[model samples]
Target: MPGYSPPVSMLPSALQTRVDAVEDPVVKQLIKDIVAFYDTETPEANAQDIIKDAEVYRGLGMILPERRRADIAIKQDRLVVIVKDKVIAQGDWEMYDLVACLPVPDRPKPTWNVVIANSTGKDPASSIVLTLTDVAADKFIENAKPVSIRQALLDSLRPYVKEVYDEPVLHVTVHQGSREGVLSFLHRYIIFGYRKPLTILPLSQISNLSYTVVTRLTFNIVVVLTSGEKHEFSMISHDSYEAINQWVTDRYLEDLSLAEERRAKKQRAGPSELEAAAEEASQLPEAEDDSDEEEAEFSEESDSESGGEEEEESDNAGSEAEESDS
Candidate 1:
C-alpha cells in the first residue's frame, strides 16, 4: 500500500462546536462515528452494519424521535452528511435538495435544506414524510416548537428565500410491510413522478432526470416550472428522467396558461380611476351648451358697441365742418 495514512480525524472548528452543543448521547455518538467514518476510507459499509454499530440511527423506532438521526440533518449550525467517499447511497448528504442563498458567483449560503432516508430495512418499499415546521428557539430549550415557514425569517430575508414545493411529497420509502400497501404506494409514486411532467409546463421543457446506482437507488430529477421555480427531486424511484420531464412539462404549461388567462380577464374588467372618471363625465348633461351661450352674448355686445362708435364719429365730423363755414 502506498503510504497508507489513516484518514486524519479532523473537522471544521465550527462543526466541532455544533457537535459539542448536542446533548443526546446517541446523536452525539452517531455524529462522531459518521465524522470518523468520513475521515476513513471504508466507504463500502452496508446500512445494516452502520445501524448495528450505533454509527447511525433511524428516527421512527426511537423513543425520542426528535433526537434520532433521520434521513436529513436537523439542529446544527449547518446541515451536512458524510458518506464513505465510495458508497453511492441515495440518501448521501451531498445528494440533497438545497439551493444557494445568494447568487452563484457570490457563493451565498444555503437557505433551504433537505435530507432523504432510505428506509429499506423497515419496509422494502416504504418511506416516511418528515414535515419540519418552524418552531420558536425558546421552545427548543424546553423541547420542540413548531411554527410556519413564514415566521422563521425576518421580513427582510423573505424576498430572497426559496422553499420546497407546496405539495406534500409522496415519499417512496422501500421496506417490508403490507405487500399490497407497499405495492400500491410504489405504484402511486411511480405514476405521480411519471405524470408530473405532463401536467407541468416547465417540466416538459426539461430534457431528462437521471437515476443510477452504486450503493442505493437514486433518482435525480431536475424540474423547471413555468413560473421558473427550479427544483431537484431526488428519490429512489426507478423512472427515467425523460418520462418525468415530459409529465411535469405538460402539467406546468397547463397551469401557466390558466393563470395567464385569469390575469388578462381581471385586467380587462377592473377599470382605472381615470377611465371611470371619463365614463362618468360622458353620462352627465352637456356643459358645452353653457360655453356656447356665453360666447353668443359677448359677440352681440361687441356689434352694438361698434355701431354706436360709428354714429358718434359721423356727428362729430358734421359739427366741425359747419363751425368752419360760419
Candidate 2:
C-alpha cells in the first residue's frame, strides 16, 4: 500500500510541500525520525528534576551562563534544590500550622501596623536603623496617652539596644490606616534571617521626635544582628498592647546580642583622623615668648660697649695734654 497521506489541515503547508518534494528516501527517513521524537513524552517530569539535570550538563561543558551567579544546591535523593540560606522541598504545609494553645496571660493582641525603618544616623550616608511605628487612633492605649513619644517607647527598650533617636531614618515614607498594610511593608525587610531587636513605642510619648533638631517623630532603637548588619524595627505601643510588643521586642533583642557585641567592637576598633589630630594637639608643648627677652639683652650690650669706649678715649687725651704742659 502507498504511504499514508496527511490531510492539508493536519500538516503545515510548508512542511507538507517540503515532504512531498523530498526525492531521496534517506531525507524522508530523517523527517520521520524527527516527528517520532516530537510525539514521544517523558513520564511525569518534575521541573526540579529537569533543572538538576541541566546543572550536570553544565558540569560536562554542555551549557554555561555568560556571567556566573550564585548556584543552587541540589538534593538528588529528594529531587530538591537549595539556594543560599533557603531550601525548597515537596511537603504539606497544613501539618506545620499546628499550634499549641498555651495560655499567654501577658500577650497582647497585635493592634498597630508594624513599622520598619532605617535608624543608622541623621547623616545621609548611614543605612536605616529598622524601627516599628505605631500611631494612635484614639486614647485606647493605657499609661497616660504617651506624655511624650520617647517616654512611650523608651520604657519598652531592652538591654540590646545601641542608641535611641526620636527621628524617622527611613528613605521612603509609608503610611496606612490598617495594620496589614504597615506589616506588609515591613515584611519586605524581614528576610534578613537575623533576629533583630524590636522596639514598640508610641509616637506621642517622645517630645524630641518632631523637633527641628530631630526632624522625625519615629523612635529608633538599634538592633545589632549576628550577620554584622544593623536593622531598625519600630511601632506605636499602648499600655494594653505592651504585652505582645514586649514579647517581640525582647526576643529580637536577645537574638541580636551577639551582633550587638560585634557592632560595638567594630565601632571601637579605629578612631577617625580628625579625632586623632585633636588628641595630638592637646599633648603639644605651650609656645614661649623669646622675642622681647632677646631685644632687651642686645640693647643693654650696645650701651655698655659705648660707655667703655668713651672712658678709654678720655683717659688717653688727659695723658697727652699733661705731657705737653710739662
Candidate 3:
C-alpha cells in the first residue's frame, strides 16, 4: 500500500521563478545564448522548448489520464495493457493478488521526467540549461486530483488476486521460447500449464498420469484429462520421475481430503441449522410486542407531565394579570 514520494515540481523553484518572470514572448535568442553557455559547460543541457514544456505540462492531464499514458487502461471491469504498441485486454485477472505483481511478470510503477533547468547564462542571463530526470509519478494518485480518477486507478490495482503456491511447489517444463514456465502444484489444484495460457486442473478433470525416463538424465511426464486429451511436460536434467510423481500424488490427495472434509461439515450442519435459523426469526414478533408496550407507557407519562405544565402556566398568568390590575 505504501508508495514512493512525490517528484519536485517544474524546475528547481529558484530557476522556475526566473523563467516565469520573463513575460517577453521574444526571448528565443536569450534562451539560445543561455543554452550555448551551458553547451560549453554541461553538454547534456537542452535549451529548446523551455516555455512549452514548463507551463503547459500540467494541463496534459486535464484530459483523461488514459489518453496520455495509455499503458494500462483502467476501465470499470477489465485491465488492458499496451505491450509493444499492441493493446491486450487481460480478462483472466481483473483484480490482482498484490497490486504490483502479476501472475508471471510484474507491473511497472509509472514515472515521469522532471525538467531540471537553471540559468546557464552570463552577463545578466542569456540562456537556460534543461535536462530530465525520472521520478515516481504521484500526480495521478495524489489527493488533490479533481475527478478522483487517481483513486479509481489505485482501487483497480489492489488486494484481490487468487494467489496460491508460495513459489510453485514444483516445476516441470514448457515450450515458452526462453521464458521460464512451470507446472505449479498447489494444495487445491494444479496450475497445469504456465505463461501463455495457465490452466488450473482439479481432481475431477484429471484422468490419469504417467512418468517416462527418456534417458538417465532426461525425463517426461504426461497428464491425461477426462476428455481423453494428453499434455506432456519434459523435466529438467537429473530430476527424478519418482519425486515428481510423489509430489503430484501427495498434492492431489491433500486437495481431495480437504474437499471431502468441507462436504462432510456442510452435511452435518444441514437440517438442524435451518430449523435454528427459523426458530430465531419466529421470536422477533414477541420482542417487538414488548417494545411497543414500553413505548405506550412512555407516551402516557409524557402526556400527564404536559397537562400539569399547562395548568401551572395558566395559574401563573392569572396571578400576573391580577398584579398588573392592582
Candidate 4:
C-alpha cells in the first residue's frame, strides 16, 4: 500500500492503462522526472497534465514510446521529435528549412511536415523530416500574424542575423541531373545533402555565387568555383530562390569586404619581422665582401711602402760601396 495510489479516473482508459502497466525502471524514472518538471504533487491524478508532461519528457529523451507516432515538443529552444521513444529529429528553429501543413487525403486532419538541416554532423548539409499532429504543429509555428510557411522561416532566421555577419541563411533543394540534395548555409560553410554531405563549400573557397528566377514557379542557383568550373542547381521554387538570393548576396558582400581587408592589411604590414630579418641576413655576405676589399687595399699599401724602404736601403749600401772603391 506504500507505493500504490488510487488511479485518476479522468485519464483516457488506454493511456491510464499504459502508465499503470509501466514496470521498466527507466520509464518509472521518466515519470518521476516529468512529475518534478511540472512541480505537481499528483500528476497521475490529472490526465491532461500527465499527457502534456509526457511530451516534454519524450522531447528530452527521458521516455520512448512503442509506436512511431509524432511526439513533437519544444525544449531548451530546440524543436524535437520523438518516435518510438527514440529522437528521430531535433534542431534549433533557425535550422529549419521548411515547415508546412499538408493535407493528407486519407487522414481526417492535415499533417505538419518539418524539414531541418543537421548542423553538428560531418555531413551537416543533410536534412531530416518530422511529421506532427495539428496541435504540435501549431505550437511549433508560434503565433505570427498572417501565418505562412515563408513567414515562419523568416521569423526563425531573424534571430540569427548579426551586424557584421549574418547567419547561415540559405535553404534550397538542389537537383543535378539524376541526383538530388538539400543545400543549407551555415556560419562558415555551405553544405549539401539529405542524410550526408555530398558537397561542402567553405566560405573562403566560394568564388562566385548567383541565382536566377527562371519563372514564377522555377528558380535556378549557379555557383562558379575557383577552378572556373560552374555548377547549376535548377528547378527551385520562387520563394526559395528569393531566400537563397538574399542570403548569398549578403554573404558574398561580407566575404568580399573581409578579403579586401585582409589584402590591405597584408600590404600595410609588408613582410613579417622574421622574413625581414632573413632578407637582411641574406645581404650580410655583401658587407663581408666590402670589408674584405678594404682589408686587401690596406695590405697593398703596406706592401708598397715596405718595397720603397727596401729600395732606399739598397741605394744607401751601393753609395757606401762606391766610396770605398774610390
Off by over 4 Å in 4: 1-69, 77-80, 88-113, 118-121, 125-127, 131-174, 180-207, 210-249, 256-258, 261-326
Per-residue CA lDDT of model 3 for 173-268, tens digit only, reads 543335555554444344433222334454456666676657777766677766787766665455545666787777557656546756788888
State how far residue 184 of model 2 sits from its true place (Å): 14
TM-scores of all predicted structures: 0.24, 0.21, 0.34, 0.33
lDDT of 1 at 72: 22
Where does model 1 exceed 4 Å of error? 1-282
The 10-residue segment of model 1 with minimum total lDDT is 179-188
After superposing candidate 2 on the true structure, give the runs of residues whose Cα lies further than 4 Å from its correct spot. 1-269, 278-300, 312-326
- List model 1 lDDT by residue over 1-326, tens digit each: 11111121246677878877899989987776675455333444543333332222123111111323333222112122223322212222222222211111112431221112221112212112232333343322222235433233222122322322332223332222212111111111221221102111222233333333323444544434334555443443564445445544454465555457658888988888999999999999965558788889999999999999999999999999999999
Model 2, span 109-158: residue lDDT tens: 42211122223212111111112224331232234354432234333321
- Superior by lDDT: candidate 3 or candidate 4: 4
Cα-based lDDT at residue 38, candidate 1: 51
Judge candidate 4 at residue 187 and give its lDDT.
53
lDDT, candidate 1, at 115: 14
Show how many residue pairs clash in every candidate, following the order shown.
38, 30, 4, 2
The lDDT ranking, best first, is: 4, 3, 1, 2
Highest-lDDT candidate: 4
Top-down TM-score ranking? 3, 4, 1, 2
